[model samples]
Target chain A: MYESNRKSSIVNIYLGSMKIAYVLPMTWACGGISAPLSQVNALSTRGHDITVFAPKDGRIDWFPLAAPVQVHCEHPVEEYFDAVVYVGDTFAQHPFSSAGQKFLLLQGKDHLWTAPAKRNELLQGYSDPQYHILVVSGWLADFVHGKCGNPRISIIGNGIDINRFFPAPAPREKFRLLLEGNFPDRNKNVIAAIEIAGRVRQHFPVEVWAMARRFTSAGELVDRVFLDPPSDEIPGIYQQCDALIKTSILEGFGLPHLEAMACGCIPITYASGGVMDFCKHGENSLIAGVGNLPSLLGHVLHFLSDSDLRSQLKDGALATAKLYPWNRVADALERAFAGGIEGKS
Target chain B: MRILAFTRESYPSNYPTSYILMHQSMALEELGHEVHYYQQDKHPLGLTDYLNSFSFDLIFLDLEFLRSNPLLRILSQYRRIEPIHIVGALYSLPAPPGPAWEVVDFTITPWKGETTSGLAAQFDLRYLPLAYSDRLHKRQSASAGSIFVGNTTGNKHKEAGVYLDELIGERSVFCIGPEFTEKYMDPFMLGSLYASSRCLPNFHYSWEKSGDCILNERFWQTARCGIPVNDYSPLMDEVFETGLLEHFCFADTRIWQNRIRNLNSGAETVHPALIQKLDDSLKEHSYKDRMKQLLDWLR
Candidate 1:
């Protein structure tokens, strides 16, 4: 979910990797877990001793980590970490403030929260201005430090693996559309994507696929519903589809766009939130009018009809995906960590 | 002769200079010379009061950076009468032989080329090859694998990477650096690491590979620990011209593996007579002997 951010290089004689602790909300299946995992994997490989505290659930066995993130489940992690990054609500809920230079990571504000006071309370905690505040996108950073009046903030954008996802070598479904993310989430608007696919299917020889932990294809107008898919299965899914649909009401940073782009899947969305940072209309992706159902369906049909536009959009999407590798994100995080240590944050 | 050894206060575990100072002081002490160590920026004693405690004949200064003029100011206090000062530099040369060397009578250097050449022509230069410390003693005991020791992250470790690439996870190589091992190993454990190791691989912190490169003091520590060294430099062959170098120094990784396997299988043991010859040669590079040579050069 990271958007536009970062670059700085620090060289010194002391070259030991600092011990780090990543505080995650849960080790359970969540779309948000992917963002932190990308950075965790990158930092761990760079030789930092990474201890991941996913206390509420079982050890995260799905994501590939360079070194096994010592999951603190049975007991508390005793070793002193140089930095402990509490992702989103984990900072408020967890008890690791006295451990090290505490950092609060906000992926992006979720629209699901209706209670205005509670949302302000969470933002107030993130904007304490004492410790470092890391956001996923430029827009979220602006919203936090600008609108919310938080003095300390650093933009560490989300990353997608460029090598893992690529243009469909031999696309299994030529005109098929795939919707990624949990179906039950109201913000994701899975029903809208499913209905749009049904409208396209009426005229064109096209099928719709929905990927989630648990979603039924029977009544949902989708041809297939991939349930709790393995990590390897993701790239293949992205490659097979001609387009990936994101009908989210609000997003901190749209991770699916880059992910889909990497797989050469052209993203069709109503340019909103962090999506605006990457998705340029008629450039990297096709942007439809926000809340305008006609423009959204027209863009989907436009992709289905035109071969030249799809190829051009695919190339642009592929190029956009390469810009945000995990390595770059990790470097920016390291700089933020350094700045926090020096009290510059 | 009464010698006042001055070095900036440093923990032996943190700084290599402090570690080297231990041996350098021991060498002077071993020669029946009185060596009193005074750590600058460490003690409460004033510079004049520190010098007043003893009538020093010569003062040994380990030149890291000439920041505080503690000694210079002390010498200036007794401008009419002052002991000669000898300064030693390693890793980096005190470039341009700057104004820092103005007060220094003699300068000791490690290698022969550009690292010392410019300064040698500028000052009274003495060659003190990196040596085995007085605290270390040879042990026949050894462990299972080849090992390396250094600060892992900050070091220019291209050779270690190359060595790892060549070994390809085949050889049981123990990497003892800041991350892998304790921050720093004590002399006893460090010696045991050398004693127990079969193939002792090391790299120069300096990447000037083709030039006249002398390795870190750890290079001598491994030799003193009584293990065969796998230094990837021609300097070893040039220095240990004794035919025993052929038996000990290995150039290729495949050949090193073949020999290590032979030693492991009891087909061959590192020749004790060769070890004796090397041990006899070690004295020449020993701090005591190097100090003796320096004194002889002065005479």
Candidate 2:
């Protein structure tokens, strides 16, 4: 009976030709914007009319309409969309106050214990059974459930484009390393990696390359550090790198780790946040204690001295990256839509 | 007048809130008031502790601590001796209760105007705008940007590092806070270096949460130094209406990109006219004057 009910609900959505709207905080080159765009691409292919309500930006590549995706600038929510996906924090007062199915694709907890007004808004939004909240990591999911009191939560890990990042030729005699993202981010912990590199230089010749909008003095220690003007040559950079060191203090999900892994770069990350979800401590990548300067330095030294260990981590990281393809994430999102339709009926 | 102020302990490396509170207490003392600051943890357990130290002309309670414990009920007993005032931004706590809400006399928040008005109504407490000490004013006039403070950790919402990254892209942005370790040193110092070359020096509070916009000393310091801050709050308009301080919507990368591009185009320099307008506005809404106005309501 449940299966039959689910089938009818999906049929109702299809027969009614329900339109889904995704409200994304349109930004350039950030994980929040890219993740949603990728999901939209995948979902649009599955025949759902997906309209992305985001801030207008010139940098983002416009999605093809043939794939059932439409990008609209954020505006009043007067027009009815079957499902509304909020990518980030919802404004205190939504202009188009409507009783529609709301989906929160939470990246992290921003105003969780502070910002009372925002918390209240999220509480109200979550209480509505029609709302389906999805968090990127288990820690964030637990936080949403504990703080927002929303029991109905899902964990949809972020995905990477495997084709963009593929294995490179064997590393040269000197180990080439790369780190990406907003460099100053405390969670990224690029400084720790640099410190570890300094210590590792005792053993092997190490060249660190950082690709970010900015770089720090420690990042300057690298052979080459590229700033904000992100190059299209990123794939080549990843391939050349022997390993990607992530020493972030905290993360909702480590996207760069996955990206680097996809490029066949060994990942050595501090064991915290969502890194544990993807990387097994010894299997896929080297997981060190967060802020353990000595251990991290030791791990870097180990990777530098032992080529066999680096090779193992590289292969494992590549294997782990395969499990989280964009297509699979898109399929999971489609399944969520199907579940939402089922509940409506 | 003896004033008993209750708040969190001063962790030297903590945000300006604790430092601001201490500085404000000292300023209040300069105005012929004896200020006694008490951390929530220092309060002795049981009824005897309260009866012994409940006498004061004015009692300033940090509402953040009161909400977590039954201290408000205990404090209500001494309402006659001390008129309780709750100060601090209301973090993640539930809406104030109806009957219990009357215990608080004044609610000092970082928010301004309507946001403050709305919050005051919700808690049934009188609202007072935040005050900046004279020390901060002195710091503001200093042209050199030697200190690069970034939020390396603690609060996630502030996204201070994110802003620093944009401002200090390829430039050095400095990270200063309790959470700063060797790990964050690379990105933090790099941001500092990048910002150092530019006219504006980059500094971030790596440990503290974002402050509400009430044109406090920090905002002035950033503006007076000709450093544009990528403020996330709407209250920034109320504080700096003349556009002296560059503001960017937190999630809007285009705004960041445009600002960077403008900076590259040599439009990054702060105009004297804009600085004059900001200074003039701040003088008009001086903390002392605002405090006097609030004190009048109490009278």
Candidate 3:
């Protein structure tokens, strides 16, 4: 699996136990919220004193977090961390100015959609010399470097919890196709995913299952919809699905496809930048040009029809998942905090 | 004195600026001043020919109007020949106060910040901050959950996030934004929404909060609705009488929720001191006061 490839190649840099404060923009259940929390949990397991500082609503029931969460609530954030890591561009300038080694985690191209003044404020952070830019995908690293002209970037791609998301083989009556993410976001392009599923259903006895945070008009097309299911139950859903289809136009590092791969589900996705890190077209994943519905539908049809191809790709998917264990992600994050991050991937 | 005011006509539903301008015009009219409103679309015309239609003592407009319509340069030249005093309400400017501001005789801002301070240093600027409309904003029986109104169609999805999402799902919170509707609500309907809500959980737009501790016109209007306003800003101290809104205001959402709960239950009602302060500030900061200030400056 990709985990073995990731584990064998990744240089484990131990910078000893360091005090880290993971600054959460909100205590929500999206990839931006989960990625940092997952890293915090993994690092805490490695005996680091990591505390999650959220601006408001500190109770995170979605992800199982090992680190303690401190809701600063209007009060100034504590300034005693060895490294203060901020994710995305939601908060004000210098949120933890006094806190030690500052790192800004670039999750996606979210700033493009914000108000012009606010967008400028977000982009300003990327160019600031005080912040060490850390991104999930290599594409994002290039984005910051090309856009902001900043060379200090580290690519610490998101990790999957193998323990939580592993293959659970079970007899299925019908081939199930899965879709996940917040459908309402225009960037996610859930309508395209639904369209692909509807087209797939016409050819085969396919039951389209969707795990979404919000139900939109496109959601009506999905056969079975799960709204914000707990993290623990996600693997079971992935295991039952034969293929996971994602038609997202943009992704910082598409985590769902990797998680599905870990659960032995073949990923049928678009060339959504971040997914290109692991999703090798016609090998591990069936990746079409972004927004190309015909090619996506063709790949799904071919994968379902050819059992030999399915077996080979499933193995490829498993190998891809083996590369991104949470512990390794935490190891890279520790190096990033210690100012030992290798240059952008 | 005859006053000609230019304001934006096409404001989306519940836009605070629309209500602010409405109240300003109403106050001017109430003060026995002859005020003629020339409402225009977002892309306004200077309408130099239209200006010739009226012989006015003073012309009132937003500072943004000067930046948008270059034809206003004709109006600036007309200002030299005519005995008309041009006043611009400076909420924000795209660029620094430049030659465009030369057309404006006086500048007024409803904010106290470095921006206003810098402008004050360079120009004839007055710190005439936001005030509630007593004629419109009045208390009514409220039973619904806490509410906030802003441009949710934009990046507010990122800003409001879980706090707004959970409230929208769990409570009777009317988190109305542009995403809900594009129709502009009349002042009465807007006031009703404020007064009917249990509380106003005020989250400032990033620009509003950036360096400048400026309170929105919504804050002043909502305060008059007799609902607890859980807001953030050091400007609260500057705007309100000492310790008047401190207990009612919160910088944290947890404490904000507590304040809302306290108001919802019989445990807490609108504090007598805050009500008195709002009443006193209502008259003190009203558009009447603003108009009187403008007249006083013109004299």
Candidate 4:
């Protein structure tokens, strides 16, 4: 009697007209909110009903969030959604109904995982059969699996808005290094970044672009610094820069690296966290051991002195960025929605 | 008191925290207490052997050592008689005790606030503020400009160093720590340098991260050498009540500037009463007194 299913494609990977709900924060500056918001738009175009539950009623101009992806505080539980994606640590607290595949989208580790009541309890949430983890990087997936009680996890490269970010002409008398992050956060490793920048500046005469959150002075080490810039200005800033230098020991997905990569800027970062997925060692980006000033200096100096290597890496980085459009992310989500339902049933 | 002191750092002390521990051990001995020190770098197994073998009147556990052992960890299993166990460390610590807190009799920390001590009541927490040893109390023949000793690799630290430079004006400020030189100095060597500087200066990066705000080992080192400190820190309010404004604690940066200007003009300001206060503080806040208080509680 099931022979009638012969009309279906080779594999029924596509979830036809599935209803999905994403619970996220309305934060303007948060990378966690922006990454998912970009994907939700792609999913909406693919004919999936997307509802985003957020407490805020209004919207900011820069975020590129529009139609089909509904943002409301009220739960659409009465509609019986097929899949539920809880965004980061804050939204992961929302309750899941007896039905639907629950996925916890973790954008970073360390700070988010340890800040809560206990670490073991968070791991147990991932281990639960009712829930599956959706992280953007292999490093994060491995990190979560090792910590959690269960090995239920998946890695989908966080898609980029390829249209908004691209290479632009700018002054490059000395190689421009971009460092963007909240200065107060310990996880950002702000002090270590400044030290790494200083080591490079003394030898190479490099200019540092520090978009430091709540900062007064760039100090003698950093060449240029700004307190706040509009979110849209980030892509242009990345385009004009030669490289993105970071020192964070723990990261879920280093978003700035991805944004900079789209604009043809090479990244020199710690071989830690999700960003390692795109910023492959010696191929598209330079890698260094976390908190090792000497090793970081070696990479920065190599990038500054070598022009042919920078051009080669810049081409490699741009090619890597092109591979991750929001549509590709939506395709992965469709597979997860279909497979998860089959497993649960 | 028959005390056993433990450390995770080198025994001779190459860093600030270890210097505090080494000085604390020497002070206990100076108070006529028989003390034996075992450091992890050299004597890891010897410490374990002693733990399983000896019967002591009191045990002083470093925060690092208490968390080192896993299988043969707890003191109750090795000892025939109960020793007054105290766990303390010079590192920046939070209020709630760690895994070993329930097993210990008391916790010795530098953080002095109602909230921290209140939360640590179950472990009978003792507030032993950071103090310089009696060995560093000698006055120098000729003292000059300030000396800054702390990390400088950090942006905040570098910024603070620059701020100190502005306050000191044309006068010399010798900064002999990270970014200056890598060579490690013991307490005696560090003390000799402390005595030469007219004022020992430090600045706060974040009060939340710092233990007890301003009650650092720098304050004790300055007082012992009869030097003035230039900074606004509320933690000194506990010890210097009456002379909070005049006696070494400068609330205003401008006032600190004027004081340094006056010092450069050649007028010695170390009053006899202030000298007496430093001596009294050295005796009152010694690790010897801290141990005695815990022992009394244990009895």
Q: Top model by TM-score, which number? A: 4
Please say which candidate is ahead in TM-score: 1 or 3.
3
Give candidate 3 regions above 4 Å deviation: A1-13, A90-94, A218-220, A340-345, B1-299
> What are the per-residue Cα lDDT tens digits for candidate 2 across B50-157?
233223466655556556546767776656444444333332224344444556665555444444456666764454545444433321332333334433334233
| Clash number by candidate, in order | 4, 25, 9, 1
Q: lDDT of candidate 2 vs native?
A: 0.56
CA deviation > 4 Å runs, candidate 4: A1-11, A57-60, A68-76, A90-93, A96-99, A110-121, A212-217, A226-228, B1-299
What does candidate 1 score on TM?
0.50
Off by over 4 Å in 2: A1-18, A62-75, A91-100, A112-130, A216-220, A229-231, B1-299
lDDT of 2 at A342: 62
Model 1 misplaced regions, further than 4 Å: A1-7, A10-16, A68-78, A111-120, A171-174, A216-220, B1-299
Predictions in order: lDDT: 0.67, 0.56, 0.71, 0.63
lDDT of 4 by residue, B60-85 (tens): 66554555455226564544345455
Model 3 per-residue lDDT tens digits across residues B245-298? 666577777666667656655576765666777666555766677778878988
Q: Which digits, one per residue and each the tens of the lDDT, describe model 2 over residues A1-345?
A: 111112333233443344777776655666667788787776677666777665544346433223333444355677777777887765333434563566778775444333678756766765556567766777666655664677666666789878777787763877887766556664465766776666566557788888776676643467787675443466677888887878765567887788888888877776545666797755677665444444445456667767788778877888998898877666555555556666631
lDDT of 3 by residue, A116-234 (tens): 79878888888887778878887677677766777767778899878788998888888889988777666677777887787777678888899888966544557888887877788
Residue B213 lDDT in candidate 2: 35
The 10-residue segment of model 1 chain B with minimum total lDDT is B88-97
- Model 1: CAPRI class: incorrect
